[model samples]
Target: MLAFREFVRAAYPLLSPGASITLPCKSGGGGMRPWLMLILRGRTRQFVNEGAIMDTIERAGFEVACMDEVASWADVGAVAREVDACDVLVGAHGSGLTNMVFLRAGAVVVQVIPWGKMEPYGEGFSGALAAHMGLRHVMYSIAAEESTMYNRYGEDHPVITDPDVFYRNGSNAKFYWREQNIWLNTTRFAPTLQMVKRMRRE
Candidate 1:
């Protein structure tokens, strides 16, 4: 996830305040919420990183806008308001889904996912809704960056064993890691590019 924050900085050097972000309101959930939101807002804001990637987004010129991380519904409302104020709502997979509540009707959402796995059934529905609602649902592929699994558990893990495919590899490699090059391009990322292009046109 820190890699993502670095990538955002390296990719977009002209970010600004209008580029607000609503972080996930987790207490100790090993999520990218706190750090990312703080970087985007330029102040302490009120999100976590638990001490992760903030300098990178700052270097890129964006600011984080976090809401409270209290144990109540009011905190949710605050996060929602912060999300609604952004031009783009950037988030990790599951946490990104939560941002939907805060997002203004047509705000663009960029969802980050691991590199090489088949797209899940539910995500397709979300994409369809994004298309219909004029909200851009961009997919950020992690394959190119080499982020497979984190030491701590999170929901963004790739589902590798589908009966027909065995793995996302178009090849017959016995292991998923061995077929990385192929699966990274064909399965893990093509649809993400497709989604981005589709959203851009919309």
Candidate 2:
């Protein structure tokens, strides 16, 4: 924890004392939380239809905000605050989910994973992170047809069968990360967004 704070301090030395990102405390001018934040990862894992995703999230009744690990200038303090304000944190299976350590209780962390057996990762690492942080975990598994990998290596490649070995090699992992992108089927993704929206806020 000390190491993480030090990293955050180094990365964002400019944070104001009260700096924070917040979802509106009321929705539709009513007494209920008006806006919820759905943070999309646009950095390491590229989403083919980013606008479509934002639209889907908005249509599901959430007010969406996006942060890219590579692109955004948002500092760790801001991100931690966003996680505190956020209802759902959306991203592919990656280290971005590690930021959930700042998430508030009952919030959701949605991990969108690839076709190659990246399970337990969502259920293992991110889920455990959420559990430890008092946050909820959701998964968005990319189907074979939805994954670009299906077209590149066919279904029988070791990339599909023995991801353990394939990923163990740095070059292979780089190639896989560079080439594999998920084409999300928004129709299938909306329900989960709605579920997050309706989840009782902490």
Candidate 3:
């Protein structure tokens, strides 16, 4: 990771200095800054209450940066520099979390697990990789009520009530992975942010 970051820095000399998106911290004092990057998804698995989530992050005393706004994949060096500047990377389970490699060791990667028994994928995809990279891994599993799936399928539907059976066929996983977006209950998610704050301090 260190070598890759150095290479990126050498390759994109200008991008290294000004890649961060500056947002005011709610907390007045600052020393070793803790940054929280929220990975924004355009099509699916978006936070329906993203404003509330940002408020929660600000209240937790970290400067928040929206991923899509700050970095573009077309420029790998820019994306690496942007991510490398952050102390915490928060994103739903997807290809976006792959950016964790750019993060320094001891930084936090908070993976938001969507509904439909996606724990294994969440753990396998990014959680384990975060640990492998010496970064802390935190997961915020979306509660049934917090997911759009609850409203679409109802309380008793197999997708909600029996996800294992619903996902027995491999292709059926797309309904959860591609078709769903989240309405995160910030009240429930605040604790996870608090945990990240504590981790950053330690």
Candidate 4:
């Protein structure tokens, strides 16, 4: 997720009206799932209670689109051209479509990695491939500092609490970060499609 954070940071400076922010997803939910649940369930109001990460980004005054929401995933080749035209690309989890589009277009991509939940995307291969391809290292999306977890069992008590203590109660589980590197920041052009292909073959 460090890679994603750096990407965001780098892109943040470049972001302006009409900038493209490509968000990749497996269906709809990605690493932003947990936060979504919290907002929907009235557990938290962070990010302005946005329904999804894409929504939040859109509210930030940037042009955002989801690859999964497009006509078809197979059409990524054509879609990549569109992604390339964007100012920046933001992807979550294994990077899925974002990696493919960015690599093909030789555009900047920011990938998010979850801490606690490891979604392997063949870092070695992608890193090497992107490097050879000249993808830029941007930002990362690691665990946030001062992040707190909460329990569902505590109705009368605070719904949100520290993850450490909440886990002890055997209730809800949440992840919190304080400037941590659970996520990796990377910049590689032409990500290793072979690794992604290999994983799919598995």
Q: lDDT: which candidate is best?
A: 3
Where model 2 places Cα greater than 4 Å from the true spot, the runs are 1-44, 71-74, 153-178
User: How accurate locally is residue 69 in candidate 1, as Cα lDDT from 0 to 100?
Assistant: 29
lDDT of 4 at 183: 18
149-186, model 1: which lDDT tens digit per residue? 22222333333323245443544233233323211222
- Residues 26-102, model 3: lDDT tens digits: 33245555777788877778888877888788777887777763245767766677777888999988888887877
Q: Any residue pairs clashing in model 2, and if so which?
A: 26-34, 27-33, 27-34, 120-124
The TM-scores, one per candidate, come to: 0.44, 0.70, 0.84, 0.39
lDDT of 2 by residue, 33-128 (tens): 323444445644467777777777766766566666544334566666665555567888877767666554566788887765677656887776
- What lDDT does the true structure give each of the candidates? 0.40, 0.63, 0.77, 0.34
Rank by TM-score, descending?
3, 2, 1, 4
Model 1 segments more than 4 A misplaced? 1-53, 66-74, 118-122, 150-202
Per-residue lDDT tens digits for candidate 4, residues 32-102, read 21111000111221222123454444433334454542243556444544454444444433334234323
Candidate 2, overall lDDT? 0.63
Sorted by lDDT (best first), the order is: 3, 2, 1, 4
